[model samples]
Target: MSAPTITFNGTIPQQYDDYLGPFLFEPYALDLADRIDYAPVTNVLELACGTGRLTNLLLERLPSSAQLTATDLNPDMMAVARKRTLAPNVTWAVVDISAIPYEDNQFDLIASQFGFMFVPDKLKALTEIHRVLAPGGKLIFNTWGAIQDNTAWAIVNKVLHAFLGGNPVPQHLGPFSMADAQVVLQALTEAGFHHVNATSVKKTGLAETAAIAAQGFIQGLPFATAIQEKDPSLLPKIQAAVEQEFSAQLGNHPLRTPLHALVFEASK
Candidate 1:
């Protein structure tokens, strides 16, 4: 499947950081950060570091001597990230994972959260990630599991597809495209990574209310742009449908739903 072109410019980045961060990303950020063996990692590289949710946690965990290079494909996203995470040891850059702008064998740790699935050339990105890691360095990242496994998003996807009259929705599917653990492991091995491991992790995704959750699902992602392009007038209806569905399946008043993801760890 072709990768969806999702623009992170304009107010989308802010909405993403404000609304989606706590609801969907923060829990996984904590999980990714805790999996790191930070003692030996003096130089770190974070790929697709959107809004610095994990960056902030990495800064807190890493030793003061370590430096973090947090990067994303979108500068607008990095702009929000820079404002959210501040540390002399952390440097922000606009970097495409397919073509990482860094020297080989430079970093002791390379990490990403919910970002790898969006890469169009998974092999090239994995190869680059392996090439840039120091010998014995670790690579850790996570991707959302199947859409059906992530209840809230599954509901949102169903609503979106129905609104679009059962048309193929590539934008919403990109994030969960690499859900299979074996597929990710095979790519990592082909990229020259060893001791590769994949784990299934499930966490609770939270939102203050179903309406707020629906708003984030509709407006806080690139899917919002797709909706706007398809029919700007349908946006409100779509949001309301998602909200109603969320309340029926998962209640409001601090809405919580199970989020499933696959975590991969490998050695270079």
Candidate 2:
């Protein structure tokens, strides 16, 4: 007999939020903040604010009276974000980056964390972001750099891919399509953002064990949602297989995942 499994699983686990925030959020704060000349800043906006990690950071960095707006396309995630939110000064909005509701030049600084890639139309979203920024205002965003150098996620993905036979894919997204430098630059340039730059940064973190790391990836972004329609009975096999692979190599010990990220900062 074998363990029952799911081919298309959509269940988000309990520890996901905790793991995601530290692994991704806290480290990217400084990168996001440096884009703007905060000297005269009065208003700020963030798109794709996952669980308010970066949103809260911007709030903390803002002047006493500075106003900040944070938005997310996922209401569920945003709701979770609101609970852990430390900044009362932030006005969280449920928004689509491609079609921002605010007036043009309404913001002094526009920022995001890992949100630029999911947008359906990069150029439309960029123009909208610029439209809402005052002249000389800036846009700061981040994306996953590349797979080989993304240590933590790489291990997780390798396990899942190996589990699901091989080359597990969702729709047409190849592993690196969204994060490729050329695509990012093109989108920014066409969106009217100048001084475009993309650079890889070092990212590192510790997960207590291989299983925890695997679970985190299983429950996290893009991957879980992307595979939700593949089938309804193969998920457990995938999970089990990955966990076995991880345990065999790295057991229940602390795992440090060194990551690589691409930061893009530009002006409107």
The model with the greatest lDDT is 1
Poorest lDDT segment (10 consecutive residues) of candidate 1: 165-174
Which segments of candidate 1 are over 4 A away from where they belong?
1-4, 166-173
Cα lDDT for residue 214, model 2? 67
Give the TM-scores of the predictions, in the order they appear: 0.96, 0.84
Model 2: weakest 10-residue lDDT segment is 1-10
Q: Report RMSD (Å) for each prediction in the order shown.
A: 1.9, 4.7
lDDT of 2 by residue, 84-151 (tens): 76666788888988899999889888888877765656678888888898888877888777877775
Highest-scoring model, TM-score: 1
Across 59-144, the per-residue lDDT of candidate 1 in tens digits comes to: 99999999999999989889988987658999888898989889999999999998887777889999999999999999999998
List the pairs of residues colliding in candidate 2. 6-233, 6-234, 6-235, 7-232, 7-233, 7-234, 8-231, 8-232
